[model samples]
Target: MKRSGNPSARDTKEGLVGWVEAKRKPIGTRPLRIKNTSRRRRDMINRKSSLGVALAIYLAFCALPGIAAEPDVNSLPKERQQQWDKIKSGMEQEYNVCIEHCGGKSECEQKCRQAHESRLQREFLKLQTAEAVPAANDTDLVHWRKTSGTGEQE
Candidate 1:
């Protein structure tokens, strides 16, 4: 009878030495029945990378409004533009008041700025709703205020 090269080929005992040899599988090698770990690790990495990319895209889109560039009032419709212009001018008035009233008081200036910004935000939202445009969230008024010469923080 020919002895098979694979000692662990059979579960049943061929002999004591054969049984021991069968139990002693080559180092760094898996049984034929076992799933390949390397392949599973590769698949796991692929899944993780895909999920990371998806999350990045989601965050980027969600932050669009907060990180938006200064809005162009002209981009809005005629009525909406006029409304935004009115709101902006009003905020400008408040800004002048903030600077003048606060004078050199950092605390007072900060409070005034906060109040003015809140009012501006409220009016901006009101204008958008009143306009009823499809793309109503069209302006980043806060960003505009910071960038525009009007009411910009010192």
Candidate 2:
């Protein structure tokens, strides 16, 4: 009878030792399965990198408003410009009053300036809320104006 060179045939003849040696791969050899898995891993990494780049771009766009320069009032419509002018003039008036009232006292001037800034903020809020809610009753606006030292409700 002719003998076959197959490892299994040798295993049956040599017992456990031959079967273990037959199952072992030679040194410096890799399994064929690694090639497919490595290719899949590379593709996954590329997809993740592309998604990271897109996320970075989206975040940059979202942050643009905070990084951009202040708006140009000169470019505003006439009515808006007038509102800005009114606010500015009011601020100037407050500054003049503070200067006159506080005289050379820096502490008093600082307090007066703080009060003026608070009033300015309230005025801005009033204007914004009033314009944003056109249907807002006079009473709502009067509350904001009352804090501004303007007793007039209309």
**Candidate maximizing TM-score:** 1
lDDT of 2 at 87: 89
14-42: candidate 1 lDDT, tens digit per residue: 54444443466676453233355686776
lDDT of 1: 0.66
What local lDDT score does residue 95 receive in model 1, on the 0 to 100 scale? 91
Q: For model 2, how does the per-residue alpha-carbon lDDT over 1-154 read when each residue is reduced to its tens digit?
A: 2236544444345464333435767664632333546777867776787799899999999986654433356655577678977886978797888889887798998888767766765665565555432235655776666666667666
**TM-score for candidate 2:** 0.35
Off by over 4 Å in 1: 1-75, 131-154
Candidates' C-alpha lDDT: 0.66, 0.65
- Against the true structure, whose lDDT is highest? 1
Instruction: Report the Cα RMSD per candidate.
Output: 18.3, 17.3
* Per-prediction TM-score: 0.38, 0.35
